[model samples]
Target: MGIGSWFGFGDKSARASEPQPEPAHTVPTSQDLLDAVDRVEQQAKDGKAPGMVQSRLGRVARTVRDTVPRLDTLGSGSPQAYNVMATATNYLPDAIGGYLRLPRQWADSRPVDRGKTPLMILIDQLDLLGATMDKVFDAVCRADAEALVVHGRFLEEKFGAAAGGGDLIIGSTPVPPMPATDPSGPSPLTPPPGRTA
Candidate 1:
């Protein structure tokens, strides 16, 4: 007998009657992937010589260009895109860390808004932002902040309707805590060598 049936907890006959839970589904938004990529690129750029970081960033960009088509198709019909996108996302942190020379934690702690060039971009379909691609392009051109411009074409091609209304939310820097102090008493030095009983 099955464990459920052996304990007299459930009817053996009802075992087949119970419905199985459905697997959870997650969609990878274009903004999320782009932001991840940009973050990695930023770290690489910051840490390495401009030439080295540029070369690596170029490679990553090429990889994105190559993979995005496949991702879009998969996004339309497969549950595997989540895993694929996640795998792609993972590479950025490593690339960033390698280029930066510092630990990933250090790079992550730096402010994303302080760049002369935009630190990250969110690419998606025009409809996602409820704006025209031209308008976005224009905004990027006019914006005072250094901006990473996410390509709308890529978003439209890969994510279809799902890429609509996407925005990149930059991850926050984590603040390190101050060391704890003893609340009970003054320094032991104050008592000085066992004076008296």
Candidate 2:
């Protein structure tokens, strides 16, 4: 007897499977985050008790004062900026890889080989930007003739211990050459003039 017959199976297609329902919880939107930022900025501006009591509050207030105007002018709605923001948010690995290429491209485009120029690794989102930014920063520091200019918050958060007074200012270090790989299966070797292998 077949296994199905032994199990007392009668109808081949009697019952129908029900489709699973998606979860009802809504994820926080970008506008929600922006609204939160606005609230924080307002609190800072109004000197609200608990939030305004911190020692660094004044510094944060000043930064907000400086950044708001620029942020308004830049307007997160621009296509180019939105594209970059989306790339950084959704596909950080590709973003970092592409970002690293900028300095190399700039260096290559220069007329003379003046060694590596100073590199400014601007990490916009401290919380959202992944650890790969750190790796890229390290790579830039290790490359020959490259100086790093990192954002203050990222420097403090990531390399705080190594960050002496404030900010991480890494000098250039020599990068070891990468071993070359043969593109084709095997390198073609020309036989010696008279002898054949």
* Model 1 vs. true fold: TM: 0.31
Compute the lDDT for candidate 1.
0.48
TM-score of each: 0.31, 0.18
Candidate 2 residue 89 C-alpha distance from true site, Å:
18
Q: Candidate 2 residues 13-98, lDDT tens each?
A: 53224355878955334454344444544543453322212223333333333333333233446443343233333433332333
| Pairs with steric clashes in candidate 1 | 118-146, 128-164, 128-165
All-Cα superposition RMSD per candidate: 26.5, 28.5
lDDT of 2 at 103: 52
| Candidate 2: stretches off by over 4 Å | 1-23, 44-47, 50-197
Query: 195, model 1: CA deviation in Å?
Result: 99
Top lDDT prediction, candidate number: 1
